[model samples]
Target: MAGSLVDVALPLPVYSTFTYSVEGPVPPAGTRVLVPFRREERIGWIVGAGSGAGLTRVRPILDILEGEPSVPPELLELSGWIADYYLAPLGMVLRTSLPSALSDSSRDYLTLVGKADDVGTPRERKLLAALGQGGAPRRVRTLRKALAMGSIWPEIRALATQGRICHQTVPPRDPPVRTHRVVRVMNWLSDLNDRENMFRRASRQREAYEALESSGGSAELAHLLHQGGFSRSVIRGLEDKGVVVLEDVEVLRDPFREEIRAEPKKLVPTRDQAAVLAALGEMLQEPNPPPALLHGVTGSGKTLVYIELLKEVVHNRNQGAIVLVPEIALTPQTVSRFRAHFGDDVAVLHSALSEGERFDAWRQLREGKKRIAVGARSAVFAPIPRLGAIVVDEEHDGSYKQSEGPRYQARDVAIVRAARVGALCLLGSATPSLESWQNAQIGKFRLFSLLNRVGGGALPPV
Candidate 1:
């Protein structure tokens, strides 16, 4: 059993972090831990390591949310800063910083358990009628919207106790977690001599075994069936024969998919754009790379410079890059360019993604399968282990300032994150934010300017 109490931060209005005891290995900082708070169970992020410094009567951590901690130490520290600077709860800052799917909330719903006739009271009958109309689990809030009552718990509880309709607690699953079915060959198959004697007249089993072995000894069952042209029966037969093992493994669902595949286009940078790229490249080699402000007019090939810089950093240093756009609307255009250059190595994150998709993209980044993350302001929180660079496009846009909840400015966060990981931070804009421009003037940020448009297109004289 784990000893020492760990400090966890909840999204509640509380200003101080709470310490909780754990019964297993102490969850490292940045991991999500489930704990009993007040009268309810709530999910909180582990911000500090276990300690025995404070009061003795703290509650034990209910559970660690996942096998591995999702949030990185840099992000954990960044979130703490946001919490302090914005005067918001640490949990609220985390809620906005993390992918929506990771957070959990409690919900109450009514499920039809048995006959509604046993429900004696008129209000109970009304609740049962509402539950029947849905023919599915009806959330308390959803039923309340249909009924004309302020508090319906009395009737709901009565119906539940009578075994007519039951009130169920809907565990919060943001985008809802899911798993992938995978197949792996049995250990005995590792010996070449055993392959022939293992089975007789089992061609289907052989097919699955071959597919699994070909895929580095393990493959997603559905992928094997569809892509490898094998049937479920074939895999099942292999499993029964002890030729392969089948199991469900948790995986993220990808939400951002292109109906029409996008082709990557490379722009030939003009003289000015080439100079900016050169400057950015040089900046990356410095011991402490200064944050750069790429002050360019619209259509001056600023994005091309960013792409070039990202390619240089990731391909050369084997590190990851984050590209942040001001709005979700910009994600498509930005993602297209990044996808073209990085191929499947890029991941896009935004609010529009379902919980599963966001979780999947985030998992890909954390696993080092995807080296680039491009999305709205929240993309800054992407857990890219060895961050090489961060490019914030439209740095002047007010959309970077999250108005609600944590109210953090993404641009500043980008700079701080980059510095923490020894990465480059690039702020590109047509109309630079006044604060950023002032920073450049005061030499706080290294300023690089693109005076002329790419292809020598001149702006209209004012």
Candidate 2:
């Protein structure tokens, strides 16, 4: 019997979606799948159902990358809108919305099959040595780095043809969630007399147990060991005696974990700021709030207004928010301020972060662990469930416009996303862009002005 047909979008420059057949129940749109494209297999996203009425041949999907949809349904719709508006391929737009790690294709790994000492050339010997006998298969890229040379593909192909090495294609693995082992005292150790008797011989074990007890009976394995200057054997001794149990626990890779968090300050808003917040609060209640332009001069306390408004949105309304800064240079200060106000409720995203860091941050926002995302232009695509507000600071800056394919204006995208999700979009700028100013003038956007700086300070003479 024929399999179900679905439309798949590859990460190529092509403008069209391809049809592929699947064996089991059809994977829903937004699910990632591996499909045969010409001679090579490519990772593609299922956009929708496909019709096999006219086509004589439809390739079967090689594999389904994810059990659940990696791209949310709403994001699929948003990507479609972006593609249409920006005249970009739907696949490219979808790619832009997700972390690059998610789109990595299968890789080729080489392993030694024949005698390594009998190689024809020194380079081949080096390659074989890199893949030691019975060692794990290594990728060409890894071998290249180990050998400190460029383009080993020719040598790899020659070795393979000579039956000196074996090749295999391995699918990309998901990023491992960070985790650490934790130690906890067993309830049976609660008896002081029994605990004393158990630890009478082992002084170091006793000290470690006492430290764990002081730490509420549970602590990270590394921290517990470090605090007591104890070795793993000491903990193992306690574990063997049934005094404590060790287990692994998942931990988030927080980018701001090292920075000392600032104390949150409660500042009274100026009269103008209060009025603007009041107006935005009312707008938030609407089904589809019109985007608002906040024309506040420098030193007008625009950031404080954002913090207050986000407090209401996140704490009161039980929704999420995304704050977009124009440059990576600005992200540190913006994130610091937001983190001070929101604590771990905030997540940071940008190009400066490593691939693993970016993946973790995206996951945090998607899983609702972090309710606010503060970053640069790319952050406008943050997967914040139940989004209630989007704040674009310095909305007029050219940094918000992406220069490559799928050249999107993040400020504009934030407005569209907010509208789609029935959230309030706030664009704040000391000098508003002409398009936004005109939009406000023609009633396309609601206008709010901050006439004076906070603390009775006057604007510098222009």
Candidate 3:
């Protein structure tokens, strides 16, 4: 029987997806696969199953790169819509939906096989020398940098053919998961007198044990060593006596590390804010509710309405949410507020973060460890499972339109994505965009107006 075939989308400028045969059971859509594209192997996304009957030749997939689909089904459909609506390539759209670290392709690593003196050419000898007598395999890029010349592929290939060197394609490595050692009290002494008698000989161990006990039985190893002035030997001594245990615990990197400590403030909505939320709450109850345009003056408590609505969507309905800010500058403030309310349930995503930080945040949301995501334009694509609401703050700002590749308007994408998932889309702005204004005027969007500012503040002069 013929092997099952699947359609793959390569991250190139091509508009059509290519067909490849799956040697085993066909993987689901959104699975990343390494496949031979012409001469070079490239990473591609599995969009869906394909038919081998129409094609005369279909290359078998080299490997399924991931155990699970990197892109979820709802996101795959959302990416397709964005591609079709923006006239962008589907591959490019899919690539945009994921982190750049994930899209990296495999690279070639070279290892020395034969003695360096046996090489024929200076370049080949230099390459083998760099490989260092069968030591750890060196990346081809590293060898080229050491040679300080362009296009060493010819020399490297020749050396491999001569049996003097061997090359292997290594898949891209993901950013390491952050973790730290923590010490916890495993078994405690029976009583106060018993604890004193057990630790009578070791005062430092007794202090460390007391510290751990005061810290609710566990503390980060670093904190215990530095702040608590405890020595490693003391911890080891406790572990040896079966009084405590050491463990490596995964730690989520917080991009807004300092701002997360802000105290959460509870605010009662103003009469106007309450009314607007009431109307929006009603609309949210409907299936695939129409987008709502919140026309409120600056400082008119529009954000308060959003907070209340999200509380209902997230806490009451038990679904995830995405909050899109217009600028990265806004992310810290926005994330601080959301984190204050949602605590660790919120994850921040934006371009300003390091690759590892972004990956960690994405993983948190994808795994449902985080229920709320707050970021700039790209955060709209945050893998929020069971999305129930999306709030596009300052939706009228031109920053909502991406200026580079894909060039999608994030505000519009948020609306479409929410609609596709049967969720509510809330667009808030003091001065609305022309398209949104027109949509509201034509009743295409349910319009809610906030006339009075909280604390009776006057509206800004137009």
Candidate 4:
């Protein structure tokens, strides 16, 4: 609620968000804006509002890119928590939440575009020859490291314009193939009932056939190939035999979000579950809850306990809760639990998603349409803005520790995250991590042990 000049935190590893001035109007917090740091461009988050006083040497913001705030205030706070606790730069923490496209990053590349021959001088011509041989594009940095030269963006742009062989910034990716394969006998299947090998071949094809058949018609080629075990030659053989058919498959643009409709069954909480729920609820209502530990054996009603608490938390505020599970939580069986309790309000985020799918989940988090995000390590950043509480199921699982890049432990990060915005942090696990157990025993954290299994089930011996 200040002015047009503000400090933003980028998600880049560069340590911090460079300050930028807004010409038109200052963006509200959580808005995604582009800022320039030297020659590189960056997408960053506005964590704080500005006062527009003594803001000098600040370049104008490139753009206020997001129509709605792509992140929530609570998430921004969580990013700060990750940066501090993980010993990461604030910008780098934010970067983990962004999609590649939003970052608009292009690696410097060296290209050849002259007469394919006028590459200039022996060294330049040799590099040009390598470019003309053209199996794949090389980054200019890679080219420079090999060539041991200086900044080359200008020369590369010139080469692109001259068509001597063009140089352009490109994302690193494996070359894609334009070839196609026949997966099934779409049109011929119903007609060719009596052909030779028809029964046996079609018998094997039955799985693929049924898969395509089950798609309610028009399944993607990849789905068919993977599901049916039909290779290019097999599909071609089928095509030649006039069995099933194959068609050009367009890429699925929208990331797939399973529309899970779960009916909340009449849940009968065990005494232990009831006690833990009561203890956690009381803790959440306080000024700051000592991290609540739910130590239940596997098969104990940890999830049921979460559902009851979430139901209470969401109904009381405009914000919602985040259910942090290991990446394995995305499995069909586990998702069904949250789906049953929260239904469509659950947003799933994980690395298994395509870039577009991640964007979609981020979009959902932005719009406040999704109140519950069940995801792996990265879901800790799920854009739930008002984040009232976080339930880290299996809180001790090592899967919560990210090994590469910003290697922040999800459980630890979630604690700092909850602490930032005064949210209740509950870690529920049958087998508590030694760190959590030690922390609890020493009174660093308040712990709740649920020894009884829900629904009269026996607690697994652990």
Best by lDDT: 2
Model 3, position 287, has a per-residue lDDT of 91
Per-residue lDDT for 1-462 in model 2, tens only? 279999998888988899999998998899999887764567889999998778998889999988888889889999999888998999998889998888877777888885677547888888888888458788766778878967787788898898888988777666657789999888557778887888788989988888888888889998866766789999999889888999888887777899999987779998899999999999988999999999999999999889999999999999999999877456566678888989999988877888878989999899999999988888988989899999999999999999999889999999999999999999999999999999999999999999788888987787
Q: For residues 1-462, what per-residue lDDT tens digits would candidate 3 score against the true structure?
A: 368888999989888899998887888899988899864678889998886666778888898888999899999999999888988888888889888877888888887774567447787676677788548888877777877977788887787788887889877666457899999889877598989888889999999998888999999999999999888898999999999999999988886666537887879988888888899889878997999999998789887787888889889999999988878447456667777777888888777788878888899899999999888899999999999999999998889898987879999999999989999999999899999999999999999998777899886575
CA error at residue 30 for candidate 1, angstroms: 1.7
Where is model 2 more than 4 Å wrong at Cα?
A: 111-164, 185-187, 190-207, 239-243, 328-331
| Candidate 1 residue runs with Cα over 4 Å from true position | 1-3, 49-56, 106-252, 255-263, 328-331
What does the lDDT read for residue 404 in candidate 4? Answer: 76
Best by TM-score: 2
- Model 3, total clashes: 0
lDDT, candidate 1, 1-462, per-residue tens:
247778888888788788888875777887887788764578888888656665757788877777677778788888888888879899888877777668876677778876555437787777777777758898887788889777787777776677777777755564566888878766647665677666567776766687677778898887887888987788777777777788889865655454445776746788888888888888889877989999999778888898889889889889999998978456466667677778888888877777778878888898999999998888999989889999999998888888877788899999988897789999999899899999999999999998787777889988
Alpha-carbon local distance difference test for all models = 0.81, 0.88, 0.86, 0.70
Tens-digit lDDT track of model 4 for 1-462? 223667788766666556667776667787877667665565677777555555556677776776666566666777777777778887677777665556655465554544467545555565666666664677666776766656554555555666665555443232122344434445535544454346574555555555656765455566556755666565565556665667664232333344546676897888777887888778878877778888886677788888889988887665678888888666967777777877767777777776766666666665777888788878777767677898898887889888876878888878887887788888998889898999999998898887665555774455
Give me the displacement of residue 324 in model 3, in angstroms: 1.0
TM-score of structure candidate 3: 0.84
In angstroms, give how far residue 245 of model 4 lies from its true place. 34
